[model samples]
Structure formats: C-alpha cells, structure tokens
Target: MLNQIEAFQPLNGASRERYVEDLIFRFEANDTTSTEKKRAILMILCGPYAYVMIRSLLTYRPLNEVTFKEIASKIKEHLNPAT
Candidate 1:
C-alpha cells in the first residue's frame, strides 16, 4: 500500500491542497483512523522540505504532542503562496 501513495512534493510546484486530499484518500483507503498514525505517516511521507517546515511550525511544542489536525493546518497554511 505504501507504493500507492507517493511522497508529498511541497517544493516541486505541486498543489499542497491536492496532495493533502490525495493523502487523506489514501488514508481512508487503508482504513487509517488513528490520528497518531496519521501524523506519523505524514511525517514519514511528507518529504524533507515539509519535515523542515513542520518542525519550524511546531517549535512551540514537541511533534509527538501535536494532533493531526494541527499538523495538517500548519502545513496547509505554511505552504500557501502569498497573494
């Protein structure tokens, strides 16, 4: 199933929202309901650029203490282009 989901490409002109949607789809496909596992999987598969971004965004607290929603929101917010 790992083969089905590609690593997120935040630094490659990819649509962050679309990639997030795809990731959620993959999660649903695999019946992955645990937010802890979701966060872990996201950290593993979100690529190096995103890992750095997430780390910076979450510096106020330990990564393991964050919820998936917080991580998702932070990633989405951080990757959005300035208008």
Candidate 2:
C-alpha cells in the first residue's frame, strides 16, 4: 500500500479530490470489506498529514481507534466542497 502511494504523484486542491474519489472507487471495486477500505484510504495519504495519521494510528491502533472511513470522509469534506 505504501509502495502504491509512493508511485503516485502527490496532489493538492482539485487533484486531491479526484485522487480520493479514484481511491474510493478502486477500493469498492476490489470488493474490499469496509474495515480494509478505511485502513487503505488512510495509508494512501501522503506528506505531513500521513505522518500525523501514522503517529495517531500507532498510539491508538488502527482498528479500534479512529477509522479510515472517518478520516477519508473528513478529507473529502475539506477537499471537495460543493460548488
């Protein structure tokens, strides 16, 4: 998962929105269970944000603490506001 993130271009603004959408679609198409999808979405985040999330994950644990789905939804809200 980390390798996949490394291979993709880092994004901001509109591109980030598209990237997140694509990731969600991919996860859905893969028939990944909800839990796996959430974790994968969180792992896909790059840069300083990713570091912060990782630190939190380590401290709180991925499954029992904050979920990847919640994080992804927050990101979508911030990055893809309605016109």
Which candidate number would show the highest TM-score if scored against the true structure?
A: 1
User: Would you list the clashing residue pairs of candidate 2?
Assistant: none
Give the per-residue lDDT of model 1 (tens digit) for 1-83: 74466666765666666777778888888999999999899888877877888899999799999988898888778777467
Cα lDDT listed for each candidate:
0.81, 0.56
Candidate whose lDDT is highest: 1
Score candidate 1 by TM-score against the native. Answer: 0.82
Q: Model 1, stretches more than 4 Å misplaced?
A: 81-83
What would the TM-scores of all predictions be? Answer: 0.82, 0.52
The residue-level lDDT of candidate 2 at 30 comes to 64
lDDT of 2 by residue, 1-83 (tens): 32354322335545565655666666667676677545755464555665464455456555446566666665566555678
